[model samples]
Target: MIGVGKIKQYSNVLDKPLSKGKQEVSLSAFAFLFSELVQYNQTQVDNIAELERRLEDAGYAVGARVLELLCHRDKGNRRETRLLGILSFVHSTVWKVLFGKVADSLEKGTEHEDEYMISEKELLVNRFISIPKDMGTFNCGAFVAGIVRGVLDGAGFPAVVTAHFVPVEGQHRPRTTILIKFAEEVLRREARLG
Candidate 1:
């Protein structure tokens, strides 16, 4: 069973009933707060890479906690070991827990057995992110990539996660895909264990 205490804490913080399985929130509020956070972190860091790494660290903490909550929510199911299985768990379980919906798609990298992807529409951070011409290298999705990395790491995957914006042909909004690449040792161990 899910941790009743944690769920109750979330409800109390959000100031709403806890029995409901889900709730709606204002995206504007989230966007503004996230922007401010990014800006604040920017001031504390030396360069773009460092700034991104800091944001990812923040997301990593959230990811670790989220993984615990989700596992409890699912009645403590054994953690996934296979590459495909864990990737699916991240796309559906982790995505839903964080964003209130499953990712739009989950795919494997054709060229790499260790690489996986989770794509989503309407990424929360990028919804209002506008990069100025002077700062053409900014991407707010690094936080999300960090979260994915944290989740996978907490689950023993030890992978690198990168977030990219891929525009769908007909979709007005860009699709954000989080590419996860497992370390070589992890893949080798899996093979040996199997």
Candidate 2:
């Protein structure tokens, strides 16, 4: 678990005047830093997938710690366990805690009993991501996916989260949909209990 003092310090940094009421930070800054991060990880890894995975893992660690702190501060306790309940918590409370807004949409997969989707446009970190042709496999969406996974796992969801880019017809910015598929045991246990 992350310490309370650290979380508060980080939040305060984000709330600085430069953040401007937390409206949004500079895309250029995020992009440049993220690009450098990716490049640095690339040197440490053998392939593109590994580099992306490293980024995702890093995001997941942050998410886990953030979730813990948020729950501690707001709920004065821990988080929920029910699938739909925790998903809602992640979509609204967790989203706001991290990105300052609720997700655009949250839906369960009609076709898959164990799957749910959390969709959002204007993903904070990916606002300026422009993947080059050579780096076709690169997608900053994985970071968000890792976040979802971390939060859910912290709340005992035990799910696999994947981030996808799905652009709406009129939306200029890319929309990211995080697909979460719960482990079979979770669904079975929920069904048995309910």
Candidate 3:
């Protein structure tokens, strides 16, 4: 397998250890790279949702692999089995490892029992993105939502995760919220486990 940063190759994929996704990449640099991804995807699709889906698909795979590697490396192969425990893991552990900070909040949805939201004041992926009028509600945060979905799905919790930008009363920019709605079976399983 070919390694990305150091250009090392391994006979077997497992021969090379998976490193943390964390890097010293600057915000502007990463933004440019992500923009390239968006631009390339834009050329492949005709609509904003399709573009977001393509980006999310990319992120889902990444989130799954990140979950596997990080959990194994940091948590010693054990995984979260409960809903709240897994939510906490994603909100605090995953965010910290990938973005260098914990999410601003992980709140249970007031109207729904199986719904949860992860809010970030300045999600790294969305920091430098400026939405044009044509795109409407398109957000690069969809990729991050894909990541969260991948992590949750990998951990045995199937959820419908989507990214949305919410307006803050006095803030210059809106906050990014990742909404997670777990499947009924998953919620039932959690109840049984509890």
Per-candidate TM vs. native?
A: 0.81, 0.79, 0.87
Instruction: List clashing residue pairs in candidate 1.
Output: none
- C-alpha lDDT of all candidate models, in order: 0.80, 0.79, 0.91
Tens-digit lDDT track for model 2 on 38-152? 7788799987788778888977997898788777667757677687888888899888867778999999899999999988876877776677779764677788788888888
Better of 1 and 3 by TM-score: 3
lDDT of 1 by residue, 126-194 (tens): 878876666555567889988889878988989988877787898875688888899998999899988
Candidates' RMSD to native: 5.9, 7.4, 5.3
Candidate with maximal lDDT: 3
TM-score of 1: 0.81
Model 3 / residue 146 / CA error / Å: 0.4
What C-alpha lDDT does candidate 2 achieve relative to the native structure?
0.79
Between candidates 2 and 3, which one is better according to TM-score? Answer: 3
